[model samples]
Target: MAENPAYPVGLRLTGRKVVVLGGGQVAQRRLPALIAAGADILLVSPEATPSVEAMADAGEITWHRRPYAEGDLADAWYALIATGDTEANTRASAEAERHRVWCVRSDDADAATAWTPATGHSEGVTVAVLTTEARGRDPRHTAAIRDAVVEGLRDGTLVAPHHRTRTPGVALVGGGPGDPDLITVRGRRLLAEADVVIADRLGPRDLLAELPPHVEVIDAAKIPYGRFMAQEAINNALIEHAKQGKSVVRLKGGDPYVFGRGMEELNALAEAGIPCTVVPGISSSISVPGAAGIPVTHRGVAHEFTVVSGHVAPDDERSLVDWASLAKLTGTLVILMGVDKIGKIAETLVAHGKPADTPVALVQEGTTAAQRRVDATLATVGETVRTQEVKPPAVIVIGEVVGVGPRTSA
Candidate 1:
C-alpha cells in the first residue's frame, strides 16, 4: 500500500500529553518549543544530558527515566521516535499507530506520519516552510530559506512598497547603544512600518539611513522646544502626527522607561486618547561597560549594581539624588551622563565614605566603532577624564567588579 502524504498543521497542544522516546541532543533542541506551547511532555529515556536532567529536576517535564514500552503512547496526543535503537523507534511508531496518534520519526522521514517545518514569525505573521520535493528534504536548506525571509521582513525589504493602511499611533523604540545590529528584531520591523520617526541624538542613527525615503525622519535635537515646556512640545508633536493618521515612532537611545521620560509620554498619549506602543532597547549602561571589558557585578567581587543619572551635581539644590546614601553601598555604582561632573561626583562619594581607591572605569561610546575606555581610582577619575578626554554618553563603573574583566584599563 502506498503511504499517505504528510499534512502540516499547527497543534494547540496546551495541557495535552506528548510522549518523547529519546534523551539526546535532538530531544534537547525540540523540548523547549513544546514546553513553550504548554504541552505536557513525558520522556521515556533512561539516561539524559545534563540540560534535560536539569529541566526534569526543575519540574518542567515528567521524566520516566526508562526505555519505551507498548503502553507508552496510550494516553499521548502525539509521539516522537528519536532513539538511536531502530527497534525502539519501530515499537514506539507501532504503538502510536494503534493508538491513532500522529508520530514523528527523526531517523526516517519516509516512515513518519508528521514532519516539523522550519518556522518563524514577523509581526502578526507566522511563517512555516516545509520541503515537499524529493531534493528539498534537507532541514538545513529549509531553515536557510526561512531565515532569509525573516531577515527581509525584519529589515523592511519584504514589506510592500506602499503602506496604504498604516495605523495611526505612537511607537517608542529604544535604539540600543550605537550599533544598528543591537536593535531588537521587533524594533526593526516596526521601523519598516513607520510613517514618521522622531529620533534622539544618542540613539542608533545608522538605521535611519536605511528607512524608505517616503518615511519622514525627524531628529529630536532639531525639534524646537519651549523654555520650560520642552517635554510638552514633544508630546504635542506625537499627538498631532498621530491625529493626522500617521504612525509615529519616537526612537530613543535606551529603554524608554529608564530615565527616557517614557511614562510622561504615555500619560500624555492616554490623556489625549492616542494609541502608543513601546519597544525596549538594550541600555548602554551595562552593555557599554561590558564592551570595554568591565563587569558591573562579579560573583564574589560584588553582588549588586545600581544605575543612576549623574546629570546633576551632588551639591545642587535641584538634585534629588541622595549622594550621602550612595557612598554607603558596598556594590557597583554606575553613573550615566556624569562625564562633565565626574570631579564633583567623585569628591561627593569619597567624602560620604566610599573608598578613595575604588576602581573606576569610564567606557565611552561603548559597543560602537569608536568605543574607548579610561581607568582611574574614585579619587583620580575626575583628573583622568580630563587627561584622557573621555567624551559624553559614557558609562562609569565604580566598584571592585571593574577588575573582574580583561583590559579594565584603557
Candidate 2:
C-alpha cells in the first residue's frame, strides 16, 4: 500500500506537452480530457481504439507508433502510463520521476506518483473527487460523489452558477419530455448559462423556476398567446435579445426539430448573422410511450415506427399526412399533439384499412409524476379519450408494439 499522501491541484496544461504511454482503454478514457484541456498530446502505442485513431487523423494529437522507452517524458509536463505491460509502465513512470514529471499509472496507481481523480463537469464547474484512503482508494466511490455533484448541478440542485463572457447568441435547446432529468447534459449546462429563456408550454416547465433572477423568462403560450404570435415576431425577439449581447435560450419540448419549429429559429438567427448552437433533447414521441410501458418499436413485433403530428385534422386541406399510407404500415404509429384530434385521426385510420382492434396507448404528461397511461384498442381509443378527458401533449401509440412489454406502472 502507498501510504504517502498527494496534494491536489488543477494543472494548467493548456498548450503544454503531455506524454501518454498507451492507446488502449485507459488511454481512451483519459485522452479526451487532456485533449479538451488543449494539451499538446504525444501518444505512444502500437495500436489504438478507433476513436483515438480518428483523433490522431484529425491532427488533435501527435501519435508515436511504437513501444514506450526510457526518456519518453524528458520534455513532457505531465505523463500517463497506461500500457498493459507492467515492465513498460514501470519504466515509463521511473523515467517521469527522473525528469521531475508527475506520472499517473493506469494499472497500478499506488506505484505512480500521481492519481487521477474521478472527474465531472457542469455549468463551467469541474467536480473532482479523490480518495485519500491509501489502503483502499476505490475509484468507484470517488466517481459516485463526482456524479452526484454533477447531476445536482445539472438538475438545479447544486446551484454553483456563473456567467461565461456574455455570449450574445441563441442556443436552441430541447428540454426533453416533462422530466427535468431527461434533458441532455449540454442542454442543461446551456440552460444554466442563459441570460434569457424563451420557453414553450409543453417544455419542461419545472426547470424555469430554477433560473436565476437575472435571466428573463418568456412564456410562449401564456396570456399573450406568444406561440400564436407571427413567427416573424418570435424571430425578431430572439434577434433583438441577442443583439443586446445576452445569451438567449429558446427552450422547446422534446426535439426542437420534431414539429417544434427549431429550424425556423435557427435560420432566423443565422440570417441575422448571430452564432447559434442546437443541443438535441430526447423526443417525447419515443420516450413518452416508453415511460408508459409502450415500446414504439419492439423487436419481432414492430420493425418500423412513424411519428406524425396530430394537431391538424385529416380533413384539413393543409394537412399532408397520407392517412391511407399510414393505415398500411404494420409497424407502430406515434402521434404527438393529437389528443384533441384522436377521434378523427382514429376514425380515418380505421376507415383506411387499419384494424379497429390494434392496441393503442395514450400517455399523458409522460416521464413526470403526473404521467398517466390509458390502454385502449383503436376502436375504443376515441371513446376512452373522451371518458378519461385526456388532453393535448399526450403521446398516442398505435400498434401491437404497445403491448409488447409487460405493462409498466400503469
Candidate 3:
C-alpha cells in the first residue's frame, strides 16, 4: 500500500491526469475540480447521467461507453472509483495497482490513497474543512457557526452594530450571488432604511429598487475594472456618514468575509474609533449555480465541494489554486467571471487533464429575468462563446450539476 501524501494548503489542479470510473452523479461530482485543477479526465462507465453526457459532449472529458474493466487503467495516473457497486470499485483499484497508479476508492475512503475535503474558497483564499483521523470538524458546532454567519447577513445587526443605538445605521452587507431576491431579509430591510446607499458596480441593482426615491443613491463612482474610491476614502465616507448619524449601508455581493473585502472596511472603521459588525451573505459561489438548478452536492455526484474565484491578480505568480492537486479532487467548480476568462480557463483546465470536451455552462445573470445559458464543452466552449454573445455578471459552471439546466443543442 502506498502511503498517503500530506495535503498542501490552497490546492488546485492546473495540469494532471485523473480517471473517474463511474457515470452516475457521484462521478460527475468529481469532474469540476479535476477540470479546474487542469487535469485531463477520462470517464469510464456503461451508464452516464445527463450531466456526464454533457461533459463528454463539451470535450471536458473523454468518455468510455463501457463498464469498468481491468484494462481501463493501463495508463492512469490517479484513479477514482465511485460506482455504487463496491465490487466494481475494488476491481478498478486492483487494475490501477497493476499499472502502478495510485487510486482512491470512494466506496472505501480508508482504502483510497487520498481523501476529499469540504472547501470554501474566495478571493485567493481557500479554506478546506476535513473530518479525518488526524483532523476533524465538529458537525454540531459547525452548523451553528455557519448559521450565525448567515444570521448576520439576514439582519444588518452584524454589519452595523452601532445602528442599534444611532439615529441612522451603517451596514456593510453582502447581497449573495446574482439573484436580487436572495439577499437576506436583514440586508433587505437595511437597504430600505438607508438614507444613502453606496453600492459596488457588481451588486445586483434590482435589490436596490425597493429603496425610497427620497433616499439618495450614489454609485460610489467606481471605475469599471479599475480602481475608483480607495479603501481609505471609502472608510472615511462611512465614518463621515455615521458622524452625521445617517443610516449608511455598504452593500456587497455574496458573503463579505469570503472575499468581499469586508474585513478591510471593518478594520478601517475600528481604527477610526467607529464600531462595525459583519453580516455574511449567501455566497454566489454556491448559490447562483444552485438556483440555476444545480446542486453543489448530491448523493453520488460529490461528497464535498470547493469554491474558488476566477479573477486572479496580474502580478501574482503564486496562484492560490494548487492546480496539480485540485485536478485529483472530486467536486463542483463554480467561477464568478463566466465570460471574461472562460476561454483561457477552459484551455487551462483541458491542458491539465480535464477532457477538452468537458461540459461547461455560462449562466448570465443567474436567477434573474435576463438569465441566459450557453452549454458547451471545454474544447468547444471558446468557439461556442464566439458564436454566442454572453455579457458580464455571469457565472461559469463546469460539472455534472450543469446537466440539470436546460439542454444545449449540439
Candidate 4:
C-alpha cells in the first residue's frame, strides 16, 4: 500500500456523462464496463480501434471522431484520459482537474484522481481488487486475486454465513456436453449452493464429485432403452426435495430444453407450485461434433444444420421426424441419442434418396478423456458403429462438413 492509500468505491454512472478522451486499447478495454454501468459516454479520438468504432456505430456511445479538445470534460461526471499522445493527455488531465471531474490517466496513474480495479463477478456479487503504484501496480496480480476470490465464491468454498440467502427451488442446469469446465458460471454457482442435486446419466458427471458430502446427490440414471428412473419419479423427487425447503438442481446434459424433457419437469414443478430456473448448456448435438473437429455447417458446403433426436426408430409410429423430407435436404444433419438406431436411420435416409457416399462421423463421450471419433460414409456408418462398439451419448454428424477439417478418426 502507498502512503496515501486509495479509497475504493463503486460508481453508479447510469445516465451520467463520462468523457473518454481516447479510443485506443485502454479506452477499448474500459468503455464496456462504463457502458454496462449505463454511462452516457462521449468518446473523443481522431481514430479508434474497430471494436470501439463498433460500440459507437451501435449507438452505445457518442464518438466525436476528433482529437481531444479543451472543454471536453466541462460537464462530465468522470473522465478517462487515455489518448496515447502525451501532450493531449496532459491537457485533458488538467481540464478534468479544473472541472473537478474524477479522472483516470492511462499514461500516469499517479497523476489521475481515480484508478480502475481488476473486477469480476460471481452470482450477484462483484469482486474488485486494487493495488497501489508503490506495490508495483501489477494488474495481473490484482486480476489473479480477483479471479481466485470470484472462483471460490462461485464454487461455495468461500461463504458469508450472514449474507447467505438460500432460495429453495428446482434449477434445470445443463452441465454442457461432457466437460465440467464447459458448464456456465451461473449453472456452476447454482450447483454450489444446491442442497439436493438430482442428476442425469449424461452432462458433466465430474461435477458431482465436487459437491459437498452433505449435499444429497440422486442419480436419475436416465439411460436410453435401459434401466432408468421414470420422468414422473424424477419430477416427484424434485418437488419433494424443494417442498422440504431444499434447493434442488436437476442437472442434465446439453440444454435442458433441447430434447432433455426439461419442459415436462418445469410443467410438473409449476403444478406443484415450485419455482424453477433453467440454465442452458452446450448441446452435444453441435458441440460434440465440434470437439471431434467436425463443423456442423461449412460455407458453400453446407448452408444449414438440423438437430434431430433419433431415440425412436424412423419406422416407429411414434417417430415425429419427417425422414423423407430430411433426406432431401442438402444441409448437415446432427443426430443425438441415435447410436442404437443409427442403422435404421441410415437405411431410411438412403431409401429416401440421400446419397450413400455422404460422409458421417460419430463422436462418442465427447469433450472427455474417453472421447473418440469414428468416421464412415452414410452407407458404411451403420456397419462401422457395430464394429467400432460406439456407445450412447454419441453425436452423429452427417454431410460434407464431416470431411471438411482435419479428420480426428479414432
Candidate 5:
C-alpha cells in the first residue's frame, strides 16, 4: 500500500466524450469497455489493427484517420494515450492534462493521471481491482486476483447472502454432458444461488458435492426402466420449494429440451404459477461425438447430421423417429440414450437399406475423466456394445464421418 493511494471510482461515461490516441492492441482492448459504457469514443491514429478498424467501420467509434492533434482532448471527459511513439504520447498526455481530462498511459503507467483496473463482470456486479504503483504495478497478478474473485462469486463459493436480492423461482438449468466444467456460466451461477437443487443422474453429478450444506439436493435419478423419482413428484418438489420462497434449480444432463423432458417440467412450473428460467446446456448428441474426436459432419463426408433419441427401439410403435427415412439420408446420425437398444436400432437401420458395413462409434461418459470411445460397424455395433458392456448416457455416431477423424478410445 502507498502513502497516497489512488481513489477508485466508476465512471459513468454514457453520452460523454472519451478521446483515444492509438489504434494498436492496447487501444483495441480498451475501446470495447468505453463503447459498452456508452462513451462517445474518438480514436486518432494513422493506422489501426484490423479489429479496431472493424469497430470504426461498425460505427462503434469515430476514427479520425490521422495523428492525434492538440484539440483532440479539448472536450473529452477522459482520454487514453497509447500511441507507441514516446513524443506523441507525451504530447497527448499534456493536452489531456490541460483540458482537465483524466488520461491513462499504456506505455508509462507512472506518468499517467489515471490507471485502468483489471476488471471482470458477473451477473450485474462489476469487479475491479487496482494496485498502487508502489506495489510494483503487476497487471498479471491483479488480473489473477480479479479472476479468482469473479469465479468465486459466480460459483457461489463466496456469498454475501444478506447483501444479495434473492428471487425465489425455478430455473431449468442444463448441466451439459457429464463434465462439471461443461456447465454454462448462467446455469452454474443459478446452482450456486439455489436453495434447493433437484438434479438428474446423468448431468455433472460432481457439481452436487460443491453445493453449500444448506442447499437441499434431491436426486431426481430418472434412470431408464429403473427405480427413479416420478416426473410429477419432481415437479411438485420444484413448486413446493419455490412456493416456500426458496430458489429452486432443476439441473439436467445435456440440453434439457433435447429429450431431457425439460418442457414437461417447465409446463408443470407454469401451471403452478411459478416463474421458470430455462438455461440450455451443450447437448450430448453433437458434443459427445466431437469430444471423442469424431465430427458429426465433415466436409465432403457428411453435409448434415441428424440427432435422434434412441431411448425406445426403432421398431417400437411409441417411437416418433423415422428410422426408415434416416437410413435413406447420406448424412450423420447421432443417437443418445440408446445403448441397451443399439442392437435393435442398428438392425432397423440395416433393414431400412442402411449399409451394415457403415461406420459406427459409441462415445460413453463423454467430456469426463471416464470418457471412452468404441468403434464398430453398423452390423457389429450391437455385439460390440454387448461384449464391451457399453452403458447408458453414451452417444452413438453412425455415418461416414465417424471414420473421417483419428479414432480415440479409452
Candidate 6:
C-alpha cells in the first residue's frame, strides 16, 4: 500500500458519476453525502429505508430497483456497495478496481482499493477520518463512526474549508457544572468564535446561550445511569468537524481532561491525522459540595477527599471502587449518582469500618438556582434519600467533614 495523498483539491467528485449498490439502509445513508459532494448518484437497491424513499421522492438521485450487474460499474467515478452479502460487495469491488474507479465496500473495506474516512463538512471545508486498518472488524462500525461526524457537522460543532494550511483546531472546552456563569473566561471566548459547538446535556443551556445564533451547535448529551451515545460516534464527530478547517469546541461539563472522556476523543483525533487541544474547567465533585456549604477539605475536620462515580456495568458485575480502602480513609467521599445505590454504598462503607453515623450530605441540583441540600449521617442517608425523594444530578458526600457546614442554611 502507498500513502494516500493529502485530500486532492480539484479532484473532488463534482458532476461525477457515483454508483451505489445495495437497497438497504447503508446505501440509503451513503447517497446524501455523495450528492452533497456533487456526485451524480445512481442507487441500485431492491429495497430502501423510509429516509431513502423520502430522498427518492425529492428526486435527489436516480434509483435502479435491482441487484448488481457487470454493467453497473461502467463510466463511474466511484462506487459504494452496501449489501447484506459479503460475496456481492467483493464482486462489486473487484469490478470497480478493474475499471480504475474508487470504491467503498460497505461490508469489507479490504475488498476495495480505497476506503471512506469518517467525514465532516462545513461552509467550504471537508474533513475526513481515515484509519490505516480500514479492513478491520466491521464496515458498519466505520459508517457508524462517520454518522456521528455528520451529526456534529449538521449541528455546527465542526466546520470545514479551513485554511489550505493547518491552524489551531479542536478545543476541548469545559461547560462547567450546569451553571453557565461558572464557565472559565477562556472557555467562553473560545465558544464565541467556534464554528461548531458539540455539547453534552450536562453542559448547561445558559452556557449554550452564550454562543451567537449562527454558530453551529450539536447536542451529545449522555444521561448518567441511562442510555448514552457510543464513544466511537463522538470521537469521529470531533475529527470530521476539524477536517473542515473550522474551530471546533467540544463543550463538556467540568474539565475535559478530568473523567470527561476527553482522552478517548484526543486519541481518536490523533489516530485520524488531526490535531486537538484541551481546556479545563471546574468539576462538580468539589463545586457541588461547596454550593451546599459543605467544604470538601477543612483545616481541622478533613485533610483529604475522594470522588467516585456509582456507574455499574450492564452485566451486574462488581464496581471497580475499592470501597474497603475508601471506607477506612479519613477524607471526604463525594459519590456522583450514589442516590439509588445509597443503601448498598452505605452498607459497603459501614462493613469497611467507617462509622455508621459518619456525617453525609446529599446535594441535589447543585450549583443551579433550584439547588437543595439534605444533611444526615451515613446510617440515615439512604433512608433520608427515600423520604426526601432526591433525584439524580445529585452529589453525595460522606465524612466527618460534612458535619462542619457553614452556620447558614443551604
State which candidate has the highest TM-score: 5
lDDT of every predicted structure (CA atoms): 0.86, 0.88, 0.70, 0.89, 0.89, 0.77
- Clashing pairs for model 4 are none
Instruction: Compose the digit string of candidate 3's lDDT tens values, residues 232-330.
Output: 667777788777877788888778877677888888877877666565788877776666676776777767666666676212385576555544556
Error of 1 at 394 (Å): 1.2
- Model 1 per-residue lDDT tens digits across residues 1-410: 23444466899889999988898987898888888889999999998889989889999999998888789899889888889899989888888888899888888777777777888877666778888743338899899999988888876667654445766899999888888888888788788888899888988998899898899998877778767477887888899899999989999997788788989999999999999998998988888888888878888888989998999999888899998999999999999999999899999999999999999988888888888888899999999999999999898999998888788335
**TM-score for each of the candidates:** 0.76, 0.76, 0.55, 0.79, 0.88, 0.56
TM-score of 5: 0.88
| Model 5 agreement with the true structure over 241-353: per-residue lDDT tens digits | 99999999999999999998999999999999999999999999988998899998888999999999888997788999998999999999999889999999999999999
In model 1, how large is the Cα lDDT of residue 407? Answer: 89
Q: Write the per-residue lDDT of candidate 2 for residues 1-410, one digit (tens) a residue.
A: 54656789999999999999889988888999999999999999999999889989999999999998777788899998999999988888888888889889888877778889899986567888888754577777788899998887876566654544765899999999989989987788788878899888888988888888988998865424355565667778889899999889999999999999999999989999999999899999999988888888778999999999998999999899999999999999999989999989999999999999998899988999998889898899989999998877789999998878887756
Candidate 6 TM-score versus the reference? 0.56
Per-residue lDDT of 12 in model 3 = 44
Q: Give per-candidate clash totals.
A: 0, 0, 45, 0, 0, 11
Over 4 Å off in model 2, which ranges?
1-115, 120-142, 149-164, 223-230
Worst 10 residues of 2 by lDDT: 221-230
Candidate 6 residue runs with Cα over 4 Å from true position: 1-168, 222-229, 313-318, 407-410
lDDT of 2 at 203: 88
Give the range of the ten consecutive residues with the poorest summed lDDT in model 4. 221-230
Global lDDT of model 6 = 0.77
For candidate 2, what is the TM-score?
Answer: 0.76
Better of 5 and 6 by lDDT: 5
185 Cα displacement, candidate 5 (Å): 2.1
Models, CA RMSD each? 5.0, 4.9, 21.9, 4.5, 3.4, 18.9
Q: Assess the local accuracy of residue 175 in candidate 6 as a C-alpha lDDT between 0 and 100.
A: 73
Query: Candidate 5: misplaced stretches above 4 Å?
Result: 1-3, 44-59, 62-72, 84-99, 152-162, 222-229
